[model samples]
Target: MRAVAALARRSVRAGSGRFLVEGPQGVRELVRYAAPSVVDLYVTAAAAQRYAALVESASAAGVFVHSVSDEVLAAMADAETPQGMLAVAQQPEPTLADVLAASPRLLVFLQEVRDPGNLGTVIRAADASGADAVLVTDSSVDVFSPKVVRSTAGSLFHLPVVTGLDAEATLAEVASHGIRTLATEGEAALTLPHVDLAGRHCWVLGTEAQGLPDHLAAACAERVSIPIYGKAESLNLAMAATICLYASAAAQHGTQ
Candidate 1:
């Protein structure tokens, strides 16, 4: 219990090279896609019974399973209402070089995005939209944080998520591959529909509060905006990213 609780902290997860995946959805996905990295799984008796197949899968993959009381499961979990299932898995470390080598046509670059839910949703959206990978600047929230992991619903293990990147260096590196960087802003002259989304490109998103920095926006190949048709003053970062990513997906696939 003490060791599992310790993994909740960023420092501990960093030192241990491991992070927690909470809830049955996240755990099921983790077990299904990343079974090799799963070290241990904790489940309540009820959860074990309800998700017997998942537990069996984990066991077959050689992951140690611990059946504990609900109280005990809560003690080791980050959420108040433990879902009766959690898994500890090694963090994947992928480099920009590795992502580039895959020749991804669509990408999302998060700049100093501090909200875990927002970051995770963007990753999920990226994966759903068939984006090749997701990149995060060093200033962004820890990608492996509990909330982020849960928000991903297992998409975290589906794609290459290169984290701790230098903003300018990554921009330059992707540019070398003929990937156009499009900085999303509310005030940009070019709107989403106007931008050319058919080619290899990357959508650069900023923090929730500040959006993208002016300097970074200027550095991008194009500064684009998503049109607001309703009374809402602006779109949530995650919502905007989903729209942009899907727009790019539709365009690139010629389904529009």
Candidate 2:
């Protein structure tokens, strides 16, 4: 119990080169994916019985499983109500080069994004849109933070997520690959729907409160906005990103 609680801390996770994935969905997907990095699995006794196949699969994958009381499961999880399952796995990271090498046509870059929930939603949206990868700038929140991980609902493991890069340098790097970088702005005259997204596009989103910094916004090849048809002042950061990314996805995939 003490060790499980300790893994909840970021410092401990960092030092141990391992992170916790809570709930049955995340753990089941981890096992289904056959991710070799998963080292440990914890579940409640009832949960083990209910999800016998899942437990068996994890065992077949060679992940050590421990059946404990519901109390122990809660103690290990970051959430108040852990869905009776959790897994400890190594945190995987990829570089800008790795993202580019994949020849991803659609990409989303989270620039200076500080909110863990918003960042996680952004990653999920990116995955849903089938973006090549999601790049999180160095100034963004810890990608592997508990809140972010839970919010992602396991989409964090679905796609290549490049982290800890300078926004400006990443912009330049993707631009060289013929990937036009666009900074999302709520008020910019150029709306997302009107843009020509026939080729690769990397949409860069700023923080929730400040949006993108002026300097970084200026650095992008273009600054584009999502049109607001309703009377709402503005869309939430995650909402705007979804609209922009899907717009690109629709435009590009429609052609293919």
Candidate 3:
């Protein structure tokens, strides 16, 4: 129980270099990715009865399973309704250089993004779009926050995410890699679909209320906007990011 509580705290996660993954789907993803990395697995007796197959699979894979009290499991879970199972897995250290070395060179830089849900959704979209990685600036919320991790729906395990980058330093590093940086703005003359997104690039999306910082926007090789004819003042950051990523994916595949 102390171990479970420790895993829930960010400072402990950083010190231990591990994070918790809850729910059957999340645990399944961890198993599929690699079972040996899982430090500990916990499930209530009720959950074990409900998800016998999953429990069986975990046992077959050599994961340490603990059938704890339902109250204990509930206390460990971030969700209002606990899913009954959770695992502590090592968090891989990913860097900008490492991501650039990977395939698809296309990356997403999130600046000062406060909402974990939005960040997680953007990470999922980035992964689905075949992006090399997602970079979260230091001003942004912690990627390992429970809300963000749960919102990721386990996509976090499939993609490389680098956090704690200063805005200017991040831009400079990405630019040094010869990757074109595109900042999205509602007022930019160019629309996302109209831009050539096939080249190695990094798309920068800012906070919801305030858009990109002026210096950062100016650093971008191009400023692009999404076309909207409705009464909505602006698109949600996650929605804007998804549209831009897909547009880039389509352009890269020559389907645009």
TM-score, one value per model: 0.96, 0.95, 0.93
TM-score of 1: 0.96
In what order do the candidates fall by TM-score, top score first?
1, 2, 3
Q: Ten-residue segment with the worst summed lDDT in candidate 1? A: 79-88
Candidate number with greatest TM-score? 1
TM-score of predicted model 3?
0.93
- Cα error, residue 187 of model 2, in Å, equals 2.1
Candidate 2 lDDT, 1-256, residue by residue in tens = 7776787787887788788888877788778764698978998988898889989999988999988888888878888777788888888867889889888899999888888899989999998888979998777888887788899988988888888888888888999998899999987999877899878889988988888989989989999988878899888898999898888888887955
Q: What's the lDDT of the predicted structure labeled candidate 1? A: 0.92
Tell me how many residue pairs clash in candidate 3: 0
lDDT of model 1 at position 154:
86
Model 2 score (lDDT): 0.86
lDDT of 1 by residue, 1-256 (tens): 8898888899999899999999898888888888989988999999999999989988998889998999889989997766899888999899999999989899999988898999999999999999999999988899999989988978998999999999989999998999999999999989998888999999998889889999889889999999998888889899999999999999988864
Model 3 scores a C-alpha lDDT of 0.85
| Superposed Cα deviation of residue 192, candidate 2 (Å) | 1.2
lDDT of 3 by residue, 1-256 (tens): 7766677787888788888888888888777776888888999988899989988888899999998988888888777765888887888678877887664468899988998889989999998998888999878887887778888887887888998888888888788878999999889999876898879999998888898988899988899999997889899999999999998888777763
**Residue 203 displacement in candidate 1 (angstroms):** 0.2
Order of candidates by lDDT, top first? 1, 2, 3
